[model samples]
Target: MTDTNRTCFMKGQGAQPRRDRSQLPPRKMATLIIVLTMLFFLAAAHNAAAQPQKPQPERPLVFVPGILGSRLVDDNGTVIWGDRNSYLNFPKLEIAPSGPVTALHSDGRLVESINVLGPFWTIHQYDTLLHYLHSLGYIDNETLFVFAYDWRLSNFETAKQLQTFVDDPKRGRLQNGQFDLLSHSMGGIVSKLWMVKEGGAARVHKAIYMGTPFQGSMNAFETLSDGWGDFTNFIAGGLPTVRRVALSFPALYELLPTYDKCCRLGSPEKYTPLDVLDVATWRQRDWLPSEYRANGPRGAAFERGLSEARRVGELMRQPIPGVAQVMIAGDYFDTGLYLYVPTNRQSWRDWNFRRSKGDGTVPVWSAANNFSSIEGTEPSFQQHATIFADKYLQNKLERELLNTAPPPVKHDVLGEIDTPKHEKRRLDLARADLSPRIAEPGANATVTVAFEFETGVTRGDVQPTAQLLQRGAADAPITLVETTTDADLAVRRLTFAGSLVAPAVEDTYRIDINVAGQGDHAVFLTVLSAGRRQP
Candidate 1:
């Protein structure tokens, strides 16, 4: 048995006849079993080592979205602040007069791009940012984290919530106990609060702000004082309830421009400076949304809000040098710079806001953290709501985040005009009119849009894309039915026709008649999706 075992086990691969275990002695069988067992364990260990391991992030990332970016859900996980019907019942989101922020119940928060009008018309909030993060090897719930809070509440409360979120071992806290931040718009304020106030700067390695209203924008006053430029009118159908609900959000008040002498108390030419942070100033001007009149907020209700805004504004003024930060601003369109208060407490609709180069929402000065210089100018012909979706900026951001950027390029920026006009994006926007502006839901309908542009603006350069807006990969755009252009006249006339099945979500459907290199001219069509026809 010993000779057979020794001969058969010789290393060089020659076949040997199989031998029965029973024929071998007990000691030999035990030795064979041990050898085989060892081989088995070695193979198992090798295979286990070969399996791929999940990659860990160097500095884990925490994505913070702006106001209206995070989806608010009730206790039952029913989404309240997303989708088409979200603003239809705007009163449901309102805070009570002199009531605690806890009056409204938005217990659950989801970090996702909002489905703005419907599944097809998604506002590309942070989905693209998230996708880029994932492509860079950020793992979900491990290396990558999302901080979603109810933006309607004061940033003070939201900052406290952010503190709680980061400290949780399963979320913002990683192996290294450090994370990077990507905050957009109001999210930047929330991040700053957590960093400066809540001692979060120690844990944050870096932060990137996109189109943030650091100094603030005059649009906030426009929203509350009068629905002058309020886009909510399109959603809520010019309801006073929209303003009432917006007034309830203390956080919105914080967005009111603290710089640029927020409002002139008297006439446009000669006026006294108004303390925008003062609730009394709001009251004296009779500019509150309480009664839907020009009267300011009920003194008691908005004092706390104004206080919150003042505290936040002070915090924003202070610099936090410990944490590294990068700020990106959009300088394409004209944005609200200052408010002009007319005599007799005139309605804000008449000569509302003086404008300057901004991103349609935030002025360039505000977006760059109040830095008014050439280097701080990251000029892009982009709008405030869509800044994050820019591919060129995204590339720059990737390099900046990774510390792989080349020398910064110098731009010969022309200084903002001294007396800027209260003009919207100074682009030759095509005026679009939808023919037979109504369609039945779920049925294929012929949709044609006629666009009129200034004659001097080059033609064929403006290829009008007609479709419902959404993330690139989510859905196919509407099929083009026809495209035509007329000979140059005083106004260049271009036409684009497309085919689409009417969405049953809402009666009002807008086709984004966006001319390339031109501004948005949305054409709304009435659909009997809700069985209530628009008269």
Candidate 2:
């Protein structure tokens, strides 16, 4: 039995020996499996290394708004400067009683005011800009900020404060410690002062300025000399209150026309420069009575203020250097160029002031600084107050801010469409009864236009007529007839009736008004295809 069992075991027949796990497969197959497993892991690691990561965010943006664009509040949190209700109340609600207008400060940090009191009192007016930035993925406080200060103070003082704000460690550092700045109107002056005087040039990567009065405005001089006139009475409740408040600020005086920069042809022989503070000049021009020439304590205050303003103007004449700047100016609206000498004694209502191309507040020459190093100067028909809301201007600003390369020097001057005749006429189309609401091709529409003339202009003499035409097509015009006239000589209404056949393509159409002796007036209307809906 032992011999048989030993023979069987030796021949691997009686009891099979346990097979080793490592030897289950052939040697070449085992090597191949190990190689394949290693290759799989290696490929996964390589793929992970090749994948792209998310991009880093853009640099921070800071907005500095123009004058009267920041709310001033008292210690009790009652608004003093930005509250339109308070302004309308005027002397009735004295700001002095509530304590001088102060900023809301906490823990040595300034909390910017976000209040915007309607269209008239547009203080802290950055809601649209902030919203646009946010939509582009910029977080509030982290990437976007508004630097607001007492606009009544000197721009130099405000510039120093801006330096402090940018250098603060509590606020997150911008890309490479550099930021983009967007400023408007008077804020441009403050930004310029900061860059030129406060070493802000090194910290800023790019700057965009809109409607900056670098060369000063003649309108400013006229304002200080004659007050806001009808504008203050109609829009601001009273002239005395606004005049008193405006006079207290030295910044307003700094905005007075710099005689050397603002002189135009007066008599073709001599260039007459503006002298706002001179009482004799006002009396000679018949702007005010001889007795009104710098009289009483008010006049003494004005003299002192003018002295400070002169110093500011001198300092501002120094050009800002070593910074990438983009200047945007507005034009094509009626802006005061020079005051016309009165033929006879006439009140402020009849005071004829010649106007030229401007933004209705700042002349084109002043805003563009006579075309000095302007990266882009856009001539908009919009007024000064409404220029900020223009779509073209907003797009231009956004593009400039986002671009890494320096902006191309572009001076786009959209020429005037229809020159407004005598500004006193205040001839504007009221949108109250505009017909069809939406204009489409092959559709009939009726539009009612109410035009107001000056007190002295007669309806018979005006002979107002209107015509409808496609924007680019001059020859194709639909004649509009006079529908009605107001009993008052100063008021008249016209109507345009008929079907305006839409062109084969979608385009904009316009309403052109011809006041025989006055001038031509035009307002734009959009015309869409018959089946298409407005986007």
User: Quick one: best TM-score, which candidate?
Assistant: 1
Judging by lDDT against the true structure, name the best candidate.
Answer: 1
Candidate lDDT (C-alpha), each: 0.65, 0.56
Worst 10 residues of 1 by lDDT: 411-420
Model 2, span 1-535: residue lDDT tens: 6976776776676556556687646888899999999999999999987986322235688878787677656567666555544344333322221233333321221223322123222222455555666655567678877787877666777888888878777676653478888887888888878887787888787888777787667676466446644433434446555555565565776676663525332433454454655544444554432223466435554565566666666666676665677777765455776654344543333444566666777777677766344335665434565466555565566566653333443432233112235333334322113355446656666555444322344333334456666435664555554444455443543333333444444444555554443333444444555444422
TM-score for all models, in order of appearance: 0.68, 0.59
| TM-score for candidate 2, residues paired by index | 0.59
What tens-digit string does per-residue lDDT give for candidate 1 at 310-381?
888888978887787888787655577878777665554453677766777887778887644626545554
User: Backbone clashes per model, in order?
Assistant: 8, 1
RMSD of 2: 13.1
The residue pairs in collision within model 1 are: 286-294, 286-295, 286-296, 287-295, 287-296, 288-295, 288-296, 288-297
**Regions more than 4 Å wrong, model 1:** 1-57, 97-122, 172-175, 225-238, 266-269, 289-298, 347-351, 403-535
